[model samples]
Target: MARSLKNPKKRKNKGSKKGGGASSSSIPSLPTKVWQPGVDKLEEGEELQCDPSAYNSLHAFHIGWPCLSFDILHDQLGLIRTGFPQTVYCIAGTQAEKAPWNYIGVFKLSKISGKRRDLVPKRHDDDGDGDDDMDSESSSDDEEEGGEGESQPPVLQLHKVAHEGGVNRIRAMAQNPHICASWADTGRVQIWDLSADLNALAESEADVSTGGSTLLSRAPLIKFGGHKDEGYALDWSPLVSGRLLSGDCKNCIYLWEPSSSATWNVDPSPFIGHTASVEDLQWSPTEPDVFASCSVDWTIAIWDARRGKSPAAVIKAHKADVNVISWNRLASCMIASGSDDGTFSIHDLRQLQGDSRVAHFEYHKLPITSIEWSPHEPSTLAVSSADNQLTIWDLSLEKDEEEEAEFKAQIKEKVDVPEDLPPQLLFVHQGQKDLKELHWHGQIPGMLMSTAADGFNILMPSNIENTLPSENS
Candidate 1:
C-alpha cells in the first residue's frame, strides 16, 4: 500500500474519486463555545429507546467508574461465531487509596441471546449469600431504572479482573478474541488470557474473572518493556495474526514480532519519527504491510512495517495536536483524523497538495477523542468528544458540479474559506458524561456502542441505513 512517491499511484476508489459530498465540509458548525441543542421539536410520547428486536437503541449508566479503553468484537464475517455470546470488554477505573484503581470487565449484553448458564458464574454460588440479597439488589435496580417493554433495561452479566494502576487501553486479538492486550498507567503492557475463565463460564462453570473483584492476572505471556512512559494506544493487526502495535507517552512506537523469539521480541529501536507523543495507530484494512499514526506533533504519518525506521509519507495534518486517526475500513486511499482543536478532517491520499484539505470538520464543541467509519457503511462515521457528545455524520453527499468547479478554482487560486460544514448531518447524541469511545457493530450497521465516564451506551439509529454515494458529484 506504500505508493512510490514519484509516480504517486492512485487506487481507483469510487469514494476518493467522487471527492466529499454535496453540502459543505464540516456539518452545521458551532461558532459558539457551549453546545445546547434545543429539543423542543421532540413529540411528547416519543421514546429514545429502540425496540428489543431492533439493534438500534440507547443504553446509558448514571453512576460508576469511567471506561478509558475498550474493544467491541465486530464479527465482520461472523467467522468468530461461537457458542459464546458476543461481549464487550472494557478497562475502567475508580478512585483508590494511592492512585486510580483500574479493572478490566466483560459484559454480556442480554440482547445477544444465548445460553448463559455456562457463560456466567452464578453470583449466589460465589458468595453463598442468600437469594434474598439478590432479590433486594434486583428490586433496587428495577426501582431506579423504572421502565418496561422496549425501554426494559438490558440484563448485564459482568465479570471483572482488577489491575494495578489505570488501564489506559485494551485491544482484543482478532486471531483469538479471548486473548487481549492491555496497556497500564504503570508503564506495563500485559496480555490477559481469558481462555479458561471465559470458556468455563460458557460451559456453565463458575468462572468469575475479567469482570470481578479478584486479581486474576495471568502469567506474563507478553509485555513490551520499551514503553517507559504512559502506554495509551495498542492495536493488534487484523491482517497479520498476532503481530501487535503499541504507542507510548514518550513519543515512541513499538512493533512486536512474535516469531523473533519464544519470548515476545519487539524491534529494539522505536519507530523514530513523530516529535510528539504518538496519539493513535491504525492499519489499512486493505494494506497488510502498511499502517498510519497520528501524533501531538500535528501530523499523520504512514509507515511500512517492513521498513520500520521511518514513515513512508508524512502529512502536516492539522493545526493542533491530532488525538486520533482512522484509516477508512473499506477504502484504501481515504483516512480521517480527530484533533485537540475541536476538529476532525477527511483526506484523499491521492491529492497531495500541501495543507490542502478535502473535508475539514470544525463543528464539535470539544476536542474529538475517537472516530471510526461504520463497518457496515464506510461512508458514515461516529465521533465521540471530550465534551460528552456523540455524533454520526454521512460523508457521501455530492456537490453541484458547477458550484464544485467554482470552489476548486478558488482553491487553485489559493483563496481562503472562513468556515466548513458537513454534507449530511445524520444524528447527534448528548446527555451523557465524559464520552471517550464509539464504534458500530459489524453486523448491525445502524447500531453504535460508546463508553463514557460513568457507563457504556449502545446507540441504535431509529430507522435509517446509510445511502451509498453517487458515482458522480
Candidate 2:
C-alpha cells in the first residue's frame, strides 16, 4: 500500500533521512571562497585588483543556476563578524548538479570599527564624538551626500555549511543571529543553532573545512521534511519569534507554526495565488502578518498571513517573470519589484489597482536581477542587472525642504500622492561583472554592498559620511 510522504511529522522515516548512514551519505560537498584547485572558477576576465572596499566572492562558488531557481533578494546576503562573529550567507536553489552535491558559500568579515579611519572620507562631526563610525542618522541633511571616500576593504573570509541538494532558501532569525532556518531542495525544512559568542557561534578553526579561518555549522540542529518539490523562498517573521513562511516551485506557500521547541508543524493547506513558482517572499516591516510575494507569473501579490485562502491585493506586476521584490523600510506604502525584462517598478500598496505603478525604471538594457531601497533614505535606491551594471537612484525631483515635508506628510496623513516624477540617477559603480545583487548597509548611511557572478563588493560614496539622525531614529 502506498501512502503520502508529504508531511513527515507523523510518519516514521518518512520525508527525511533523519540520522545514520543515509543522512551522512547525503551531506553535500560544500564550497567556500578560498578558490580551490578544481572547486572554484574565476569569472572570465576577472583579475585581482587591490580594491580597498571590495571583498572576495562569497557567493555560491560552484553551484550554477537551477532550472526553477529561487533568486536571492529579500532573504538578505553577506556575512559580518561582530564580537559574536555574525554574518549572512544565502542558499542557492534546486537539486545538485554534476559537481557532485549542492553547495552553499558564506563570506565572513571581521567587525573592525575604527580600522578604516584613514580610508573613509572625512565627515563633519556635529556631536563631537571625535570619530565617525559610519552609523550616522538619516535625515534631510544627508540626502545630498555621496560616496567620496576610499572603500574600507573588509577583512573577508569564507566558511561552509553542508546539506543535501543545495539550500533552496535561508532565513536568519531576526531576534537571534545564532538561529537560522533553511529550506532544502530534498524536501526538508531545517533549523540551525549557531553559537552565541564569537568563539561559540561556530565550530573551532580545525573544522574550518573550506580553509582559511572558518566558523560554520557542520550539520543542522534538527531538520524535517514537509513540502513536496524543490523549495524556493522562506521568510522569518519580523514580529513573531518562531513563525516562518516557505514557498515552493508548485506555487504552494506553507505556514510553519512552532509546535514545540524543536519541531514545527506545517499547516496542511498552502497559500495559493501565483500560477507559477513563487520566486521571493518578504515579511512586511510595519504589519506583523502582512507579507508580499513575486512570482514567475508576472505578478506581485500582498497577503495577510491569517487569510490564507486568497491574496489581499494583487498587482499585474511585470511584463516578464517578476525576479524579485522588496518593501521599503521607511515608507510603509512604497514597494519595489524587478523583472526578467530589464525593468523595475515602484508601487504604493495603498493603490494596488491595475495602473498603480508609482514609478517605472528601464535604465538597464539587461534584465534587472536585484533592487534595494535604502533603509536609511526613503527616496534612495540601488539596482543591479544581468549586464554587470550597478546604479544608485535618487527617487526625488523636488527640492530638499519641500521633499522632506512632502514625505513626512505622506507618511503621517494619507494625503493624495503627487504625480510620479522620474528620479535622478545618483551614481554608477564600475569594475564588476555578472552583477546579480545589491543592498544598503543598515549601519552605514550610504554604504552599499553588491554581489555578482564574479564576486562581492562593498561600495562607498564620496559623501556617505554626512548625516544627522532622524528624530524617531
Candidate 3:
C-alpha cells in the first residue's frame, strides 16, 4: 500500500516526442532572506540551552508489540490525555515462553506542578475577588504554619475487563458509540460498560482482577458466539447500536444483535459469507448494509447484511492471499485492500458492476500488511508493508487537465538540479523488519501508529508538526 509518488515529479516534454527540459530563463531565483527564528542567530559551534523546566512530564510506553488495541479517546485530542484518567487494554500474541497473553493495566498521569516545585515559583493571593473574611483567616493560618505544601498532577488508571482464556491473538476490539467496549475472542464476543469505570481505578490501589473474579463482579453485558474457529476481527455496526459483526478464521462472518433476555443472549445467524480464512473485515461507514472482508483465499468479497447465501460481489483481486481490506468512509463505492503479493487495489463497487476492472494499484515491493484511510480526509490512505515502511496516497489528485499542467510544471522545476530529490520514503521502523499491524488513531486523522518486530512507532502526516524534536535541540 505504499504511495506511488516515491520520487519527485519529473518534467514532461512539450514539442519533442519525449518530454523536454525547461528553458534556463524559466527557472525561478532563490529567495535572498529565508526566515529562521529564535536560536537561528547562534553559530553552528555555539551551545544553545533549553529551559528544562518547560519540558512535558507525560510519557507513553507500549507493553509489547501491540497486536489489537484501540485508543479510548476520539481523534479530536492527541495521545490519550497524558496521564489523564484512562485505561489501556490489549491482547498480545503468544511469545516463546507464554501461552496466549492478555494484559489490562491502569496508568495515571502525574501532575507536573508538584514534581517541579523547585523549578517553579509560587505566589500568594493578596488581591482576592471575594472571601475577604476567609482571606484574613488564611493569612493567620499561613503565619502560624509558615511552610509550603506541594500538589501532584493527575494520573490515569487502568483496569482489566476480565475474560476466560485471556484474549486470543486474532480478535478485534471496538468501542461502540453508545459507550460500550466490545471484544471478540476465541468463540465469543463480550461487551463491557466502560462508562462506570472511567476514573474509578484512579481512586483504588488494589490490583485489578481477571477471569471468574471479574465475571462475578462485572459480568459481560452481552455475549455472542457461533463461530467454530478463532474470531479474527469484529466491528460494531455503525448504523446499529446493539448490533455487531464478527469474522472468524474459518471463513465465516456473523452478525449479532443483543437480546432483551436476562442473559443478553445474541442471535448468531444474521449474516455470513467468505470462502477461506477471513483475515480482516470492515463495516462500511457510509452504507451500513454493505461490508467487506478479505481472506487467505486471494479474494475480496462484499456482503449485504440483509441477504444470507452468497456475497453481494466477489472480486478475485490479488495474485496472492488478501490480508486486509478497508472501505472508504466518505465514498460508499470505493474500497481498498492489501495482499501477500506486495500490492494494493482501489476498487469502485459501482464500476465493478460492468465489464471494466476498476482502478487498482501495485506499489509495495513486499507483502502489503495493512491499509487504513484518513479518518478526516477520505481521499487519503495510509498503507504499511513488510518492508518496514508506511506510505500515504492522495487519491483526490486529478488525472486530467490540472494533472497535465502540474506535470509540465514539475519538469520545468527540476531542470536546474543535477540530481533530483529522492522519493518520500519514510522508514517507519528503520531497520528492515516486518510491520505486523498498522492503525490510524481514532482521534488523529492523519496520525497512524504501527507495530513491528522491532518496536512500536507513531507516524503523523508529513505535513503536520514533527513533535519529536531532535535530541540536540
Q: Cα-based RMSD of the predictions, in order? A: 16.4, 14.7, 16.4
lDDT of 2 by residue, 376-442 (tens): 7888888877765677787775446677665545333222222332336655554454455566756
Candidate 3 residue 116 C-alpha distance from true site, Å: 26
Q: After superposition, which runs of candidate 2 have C-alpha atoms over 4 Å from their true positions?
A: 1-107, 111-153, 196-217, 222-224, 398-423, 463-465, 469-473
- Cα lDDT tens digits, model 3, 121-195, are 233477553323321333322221112332222232345444443343323334332134334444665655554
Candidate models: Cα lDDT each: 0.59, 0.55, 0.48
Q: What are the models' TM-scores?
A: 0.70, 0.64, 0.59
Off by over 4 Å in 3: 1-60, 64-72, 75-97, 104-157, 166-185, 201-218, 260-265, 270-272, 355-358, 397-433, 453-455, 464-473
lDDT of 3: 0.48
Q: On a 0 to 100 scale, what is the lDDT of residue 327 in model 2?
A: 87
